[model samples]
Target chain A: MSAMTHEEVRELLAAHVMELLLPEERASVVAHLAGCAECAREVESLRATSAELALAAPDRSFDARRCNGVRSRLLARTAADRDARARLAAGQLPEREPLSLRPPHATAPESAGGWRTASMVLAASVAGLILFGGSILVQSRRELAQARESESQRQRLIAGLIGPGVRLIELAPTERRPGSARMFWNQTLGAWTFLAYDLAIPAEGRTYQIWLITPDDRRISAGIFTPSADGNAIATTTYALAADSLTAVAVTEEPAGGVDAPSGDIVLLGAAR
Target chain B: MIADVRSPDDADALVTRVAGGDEHALGVLYDRWSPLVFSVCVHILGDDDEAEEAVEETFWQAWRQAERYDVTRGAVATWLTTIARSRALDRLRASRRRQEETMSHLSETKRAAVDATTRRGDDPARSAEVAERRVLVRQALLALPLEQREVLELAYFRGLSQTEIAEHTGQPLGTVKTRVRLAMEKLRDRLGILRERDA
Candidate 1:
């Protein structure tokens, strides 16, 4: 880019302070500010002006007195994030408790009736075990092996959620189901996790599938899922694509094995907030 | 962890610890700053739930970008409030777009209300209420010429670029830039005078 004139640079100073400048313009301003003491002082003055302007906004002194759960959520998320990053640095996947350890109601729909939901949950678990366990060496070790794999995948996702530079985008339910999904993604790593909560169980032959719609409108599968009896499913995967390339994520009802495209109802949808 | 963060330096130290993965430091930072952050978000987005989301995301963004923070630019509160404002504006854009898209599905009166809300850049009744609550910012902004105030609001609250503001207002790019510069300069002058007078 051509060097900006003093007059042109002056125009950009305030916008630069507000971070409204385009990337190239920002770089040019930063470059100019380095050598120009006069411009730097101007930047500082504008920054102070911005600061005062910001602090002058309405103050919720009374609201701050109440200890809402904001800090706890921040700490839980921060611990999760820091653990994920430490595990990555250590060259070991983060440790995660198996989803099976969670109570059935925590992972499945309570509205489905107690005993019926329990049976359905057990049946779903067995089917998943058989499908994934069939590849194992011994049939006797199927459950153990499946549990171990689930634990490992769970750890990987936990790490991804609190991973370095992660953005946790909460997907709202578009339908009547009382469930939601929160996605955590690190743009640099392209690692993402979709944490689906309290979703309704799919029919016997149907499953919940996630798809990411790219900015260019290409639908990429984020993989499929089945909530345990407690109605929770955690799916973690790497996209190897820039985070900005994604426009939104949606969960659709699909066949048991999943499909290449969305052909069912979108139960939940959210943009990159 | 130290429980009392009584100064900007303490806040700076907290940020350093947060960058090092100290969750306690983050909590302290949030305790110290969330109300201001919440207020900024609420003023811009005008929805409690959305404003709360902005607060959460702003702190998380602070954590993620902690290592990149430069103390020389401004104090931690300033830096954080900047992030909060940016995130709130992002929500405002999303909310406005959603309203526009879903207007046809709403009642005629609701559509008209939504249009008025959008055109005014915020809910006027809420703005008036908030302006009463925040005298300093309101006074500072009210002191500006309408042209300058409009450009400044578009740039700061709406997150519009100079070119976009120019296009939105049907003015030349040069005019928009000049108005913005003049506005900031005027604000700086007026705010400085107010500060010295208060002192």
Candidate 2:
């Protein structure tokens, strides 16, 4: 489209701020404002005035209970979003997905074999004499199961770190806090492996929350963790987002369970390449 | 919980804290501004439930984007009302689209009448400061010429484009655009003085 003349663009500023312009016209106005400081300033002034028009709406009181309900629900939603992100970061898949870390081939056959072995043992043992052995077997099986799960988590973390499309984001210490952190985002696998070092432990009832900053500057909670006594921490989780969605990563000190949104001092921040 | 209303500086400080991830500051900002935001939503959406949802979305966006707010450009109230209006308008347009699809046979006049039926009752229990601000804005709007005021209201409250406003009011599109500009300029001049006095 041909560019609007300066006088024509000035006439559109009022409608521009009110969002009454057509898409093409709005685009023209935006294009003009980028090069014309005077028009931009006028638009800002008009926008402020237009916002006041909202105050002219009839004054009405909401039921206090209902108003409070909205507040409670909103805050709760934020906290829930944080928790969900924390869960994702922790590698706890959502309920709809399978949660077992064990390979598909290892699960059913292993359980079936265990049952078969238990039946054989039951047949071979004198009932009262087998009690002690049964307890020992159970204890051994539990330990083995835990070891298997730990190894699986380790393998997954390693896989995420070395996966294709993995990018490293280094977070430098914010002025208010001293800490350095790095995040390995595996775009292809939707996994995040975050490691932080040289950080002071938070105060009682406080933890550090990690955030993923999107291109539009929205901060999405990644997860929350407390560092070890020596100020080192690692967290791993899988969240499938578009490859180019994240623009940066940050860490902030938040209350122990984490709030819905970031509301603490930024401890570390790094822009994504 | 309802707290005593604070000065604009305090409001700005709350926004600053909110930018730093301060939940308490967000809560305080909500307590202070939800009424005005709700009032705008209710006026546009005309349903308590939807207006309440809009209010929630407005503050949620505020909490998420507080860092983007530039205090040199506008007050917190203006920043919030802008968000509130945008969200409410989104819902309004969505619902209108749905209504148009399902109620396509309804006459335009009947639909307009239905739109006008959303009752706007005054609440006498509002805070004095909020009540005063409302009166000032209303007075500024009332001072505009009727034709100019009509176009502004059509655009602001109805979310109409200039072409749409012209179609709705049966005036030339240029005339509608000129009226919108004149009306907004007058409001800026009138409310600009009030803002300076408050500052």
Leading candidate by DockQ: 2
Angstrom error of the Cα, residue B187, model 2: value is 1.1
| Poorly placed runs, candidate 1 (over 4 Å) | A21-31, A60-67, A94-273, B1-8, B93-139, B170-172, B193-199
**What is the overall TM-score of model 2 with all chains considered together?**
0.55
B-chain TM-score, every candidate? 0.67, 0.79
CA RMSD of each candidate after superposition: 15.3, 20.4
CAPRI tier for the interface of model 2: acceptable
For candidate 1, give the lDDT of residue A194. Answer: 68
lDDT of 1 by residue, B72-93 (tens): 6666766787889888988888
- The list of candidate 2 runs beyond 4 A from truth reads A84-273, B1-7, B101-130, B193-199
